[model samples]
Target: MLLKELSALASPLNDQQIGQLQKTVADLSPQQLAWISGYFWGLSQTPAAAGATPQPLAAAVATAAKPAGKLTIIYASQTGNAKGVAKSLEAAAQADGIEVSLYSADDYKPRDLAKETHLVIVASTNGEGEPPDNAISLHEFLQSKKAPKLDKLQYAVLGLGDSSYEFFCQTGKDFDTFLSKLGAKAITPRIDCDVDYEGDAERWRSDVLGKVKETIGGGASEVVVPLHAATSVGTASAYSKQNPYTAELVANQKITGRDSGKDVRHIEIDLGESGLTYQPGDALGVYYTNSPALADEILAKAGLTGDETVEVAGESLTLRQALIEKFEITASNPQQVAAFAELSGSKKLQKLAEDKDKLRQYANNTQVADVLGEKKTKLTAEQLVGLLRKLTPRLYSIASSQEEVGEEVHLTVGLVEFKNGDNTRVGGASGFLAQRAEESGEVKVFIEHNDNFKLPADDDAPVIMVGPGTGIAPFRAFLQERDARGAEGKNWLFFGDRTFTQDFLYQVEWQKYLKDGVLTEIDLAFSRDQAEKVYVQDKLLAKGQAVWQWLQDGAYLYICGDATRMAKDVHEALITVIEQHGGKSREDAENYLNELRKAKRYQKDVY
Candidate 1:
């Protein structure tokens, strides 16, 4: 009877899952089977399986018989970064003879918190410091009055975010606060990491693992399974953010018109049989060197020889190479300014560092060279090297389909430029691709897989894309993919720019798509053309009834581009559409949007 039930329970299991289960319980004796049964029963006691209740004694017996050491890691990922960190943490924890179970926050029940002994929470903050979609319910539950006391729980959190945002690492901070409020004990202090998070994440993992080992001691045990045995995927990729593949640029063409305000390029690269496979919504990470002009300017300002040798992290290289390829020269941080002020004893640097707002202003306006140029102090090579942060890769949305163009990756990039007083400032990555990188030049690239932002598997499902400015990139890929698959889905695009004549991107292709019947509708919002500035949100409002009808017809809505303002306004507009067209109350409309999010009908690739 037990074996039959086990088989029934495992009916939906995949091949890998079935194999793993068979391997794990292959040598189990009758006693071990009884213990395993109880262990699974305990896990099934939560609200996730509320219909079936586990026997108390059975659960206790199972707990006593099974391995005492285990780690529960929950990740609330907005853009897959937190998921990556959680995966790494689970791997590290399991390597040390600790049983580990990893889960996305959306899949994990809040009630399970009471039973967890060792927990690690990895989360990323979204727009306006709100929790990621996956973490919304869990975050609310922890803050609710009904939250259970978690006095027995010991946990740690790792936060991933960008420093450019005001609420840097806000989600992680919220998690820490919630856990502490519920009486959970801290295993270690939470580590808030910036965009370049690997080094800090590794250190945090080491600390957490150390604490776990200290709490539960054992080098080896009979019940302990090898870490690799429990891995969901096979061997990990060798290339990552730190180490990327240097692929050659095969094609570079201006997708936009000659008179366009935005210089959008359609770039293609040869993967060269690297066996890299990426879905439509994934981003391509490009590693680029700083411009030679910028590097020369920095060297001249600092009064340092480009040929001077500098030792960085045990490797010695020319100062120019270090600045160009290794260190961050353009962007300034508070830490960098503080360090420089202390080193140089400059009153201006020290004064700038005192006020947070003023410091940020200074960092934004001044480059590393500009800061050094203002001061007359001389610095050693080591000091200069220490002042700089490691150069990081930039991620651009992929705009091509493997089905359409196999073994090749395509991107749509908008060159970033701004005037800094008398001098013109350009974005490091965009400028490199636009001006520096030559045709057939080598570009270090890698694919970042995004599981959350994929088109529906069913080709018949309709899609509505809301993208303005450079945000139209992935939508182009979506249309191409749908066209390649010969999908029956209707594609509707709502695009906006300053002017249709000067800023329209992929105009010819869009026309071609319209003629070919690949694109069902195209709505353009040329803001400056009219007396009143119009945007995509305004267009959405204008076509509220039709948009609502499309939603009713099961169309997937995807929004891309600016997260700060546009995404928020579009969201509000969507709510208004639902309210007016669907005849629903404001709260009901809000819930409707939430339901769409839960069902993955409303997806966003906003950044």
Candidate 2:
């Protein structure tokens, strides 16, 4: 009746416009309808009549002539960095009065690409140049023959990865190539950023927003809303990588045996009153300064005095201070080696840098001081500072549930130490937590939430976890949450290390959980306990029948450990188990695992 009355009222809208308006408002709430009614009435009024300063109606007429195009942003992320960048882009675009939509690669439909006028992708490379698990479906669709042509699409891409990897930003390169082949025009050159990507990412965001404003009709600032302003109802704390919270170290106890080759610390940090909350699968990012002795050693190796001043982030500091607080000196990368080789004009170093494989090997095995010592060249203060990348925070998987330990977080940290001739090198963050950080000392920290790795939502669902070494961190959190919630789910853990007695981390806790009926089953594989090496993969194969039965009964599988060898070996072992017990071919088993991943039944948190 209202529609009929509105139609009979001699409205300016034609029949088609009226029909669209009716269709749009059919499902709207009374409050939404009231807001729309006011919006429409305001659009019909002149500036003077709306109680504003008088303005000519010609400006309003011109504003109605152009409608802005929509901007679509998709993120393919493994560890949340790419997603963060995409969210910033969306917020910036909205603040500029542009119509924008954001989607994870998994949630977005491939067919929508043809409808998008402007598209931006922020992708991070996973493993050895592979797309992230959530992005596999979309990545494959774009590469397939059935993908639609996007000739009218204007796009830009930003890639994030570590420069140490041979195939840095390979996933972003793939997306750029795939879209270009489908005839989409690139609005700007693709930017591939290394681990220290904040600066470059901010610049790219500015450039992209500027181009978008120019291409689309601009100046709807009246309707613009800030992202934080709109979402402040249940927003998180302001502490982030840029602005970290200085939390106190509650405890740092050694979990490994004294005779063991490894040094692992069970770290506990107090987050009292900070309102920083996290789930089971989240990671804690820790910022630590390098030791003075190590910084002095680097200065001695570079043939520079500690008194030389160098500039960092527009601030001048002594070379030693910069080394200790601003730059990464413990880990060596291929880019640093190549730069130093060219600066020193060393033929041996130059030849080593020419080969990608050898250069990566050399960088991985050598430290910054060792790399500098390869040549006898004396570099200036600026040159010495230029050879290193900025210090980045280390992320550790949170090992305790907030439900179990209120206002506190826990971590399993393995000390990274190696010998450089007579000198010993230690990882900046690990060494800080294990040795330098005293109980009650402050540590700058933030949480990194990873949705890709999480527990099953169903309380009764069974879970199988494979975590060797420090990979057991998140699983510990998972069990804690499950126990706290009184979940009836069955839990199985496959854990391994060098030796059973020396490296069985949290053995008493596991035993207690088993006795309390919280943990259903546990498997241990100590590689050096016997003559023949036995790992988690061996344990999985040994329990192949039961593993298959658990999968058949709707079990979720998780893997957390070293990505290079352990994760790959466990994956292949699972495939073999499936193929042998499920009566399927090798390809079918692989497809079954892929289906599980798509269904969020298979998850990984590997580094």
Candidate 3:
């Protein structure tokens, strides 16, 4: 009987909680089980009952009544992509006369899942097969023994992931499985999308909307829900990802030392009274053209004339212009290779295409011209346009605060460089911003707002910022904004780079701020300065006590930089510091960190 009871409850408890519960309740009686359940239920119900003191009965009734024919959209986003998709879907759904409610996975309580009728999950998988940070708790709850049955719920999932990963869209798969196990009906099968997810996501949305209409017994006629419309208020005046504003480049200066291997630029673009507004943590999206010389090489190698008219997506333009402003030329995809090899019918190209590994390697190094040069082929302008993907904007972290710089936008760009068979190649956006764009020349740009990364509202709150390399961009803005506001906050910064002499970015400004008493503390870590490798993590451990004291004193911690190594190492270092300084165990320290995250004390702007 006890085993059966345990098994019944196992489905509702998380992996960790279930293990603990099982150990504690192994010898408990059925009466004890009932009593524990009652106790928890009472605890959960207390808040609602407490409201009876002053609330009217009508208020209680209104709360109990659910909105009719409403769509609940939940987004599990790791890097804001899924959140963008979810916002788009909500706009579409609202336009169709369906009421919509949006929630981040972390913000929504698991107990409320049972109240949902129409559910849509927009989820993105993290590195490997991990669920996004926001989705972890809800994901655990859905697979736990305490999960409520959802037999009446109609659901659909849209999973965003990169095909390059081994476990592509694993989080979506998990959600689908858990929903099915809980007896929820699938309104539509889950769709897993790769990097170019816009088309796939649109198709899935249409399918889901159709299912939602049928399930709710609504007619084929489109329903408009005015309340669900996307907000047009406070939109930036400049160009954005969808419709970019062309802003003139006012200045571009090389900031790095000449002897340094890296080339970093301090770029300034004139918003030109566009009334474009951007905060400190926002990123500027730059849409750039491929190098003209490279385009000429491609056209010549392909045996095609640049003047040929090509019709793409109902627009006719010269092949050269299309290649220059519209199509992607730097990166190559597998689909393009397969399509081109089949079109050319070259024996050598066909042989290379036979091996996926070889094809990928060739595609990575060689451009369209190099590939086409290997075989002589006559291609129509339309075919050429079809073979190429659309040009996407690159996001560079904004290095200046609007509060400090006004209309001008500043960026600390590290130009990309690599040797290709004795020839130096640079990334399109970085090179264009650094070398091609002239002073006072127009460059289309926009702002991408990041709400997840923000400064604390309290002026006096202490802040710890750890940023190395290009990751120091936003922190620059933070310090500027704080200084401009005359904030009383004590700011501590841990900045690392190659060498202090050559690579210490914004050195003069930092020194000025230190002298002005705006910056309370500064920790410098130059990895290549010493014989053995030394990073920010090393400095963090050295000052663990002070760091812990700052945290204890209600300091907000911020991390910006390399997502792969730096972020991971810094996180481990934080855990170690917390454990050592707070005299807590490893697990307790992790929970403490998690609490900081939940409280919005720990923030990361990592890429």
What is the C-alpha local distance difference test score of candidate 1?
A: 0.81
Ranking by lDDT: 2, 1, 3
Better of 2 and 3 by lDDT: 2
Q: Which ten residues in a row have the lowest lDDT in candidate 3?
A: 224-233
TM-score computed on alpha carbons, candidate 1: 0.83
lDDT of 3 by residue, 254-359 (tens): 8778787788898899888777788877778898988888777778767788999877557898989888887877666656877888999988778888887777
- Candidate 1 on 518-604: residue-level lDDT in tens? 999999999989899999999999999999999999999999999889999999999999999999999999989988887788888
Q: Of the candidates shown, which would achieve the greatest TM-score relative to the real structure?
A: 2
List residue ranges in candidate 3 displaced over 4 A.
Answer: 1-69, 78-81, 125-136, 161-174, 223-239, 300-310, 333-388
lDDT of 2 by residue, 360-468 (tens): 9888888888888888888888888888899999999999999999999999999998787887888888998988877439899988878789899999999999999
Error of 3 at 227 (Å): 17
TM-score of 3: 0.78
- Report the Cα lDDT for residue 429, model 2: 88
Q: How many pairs of residues collide in each model?
A: 0, 0, 15
Candidate with top lDDT is 2
Better of 1 and 3 by TM-score: 1
When summed lDDT is taken over every stretch of 10 residues in candidate 2, the lowest stretch is 226-235
Q: What is the TM-score of each candidate against the true structure?
A: 0.83, 0.88, 0.78
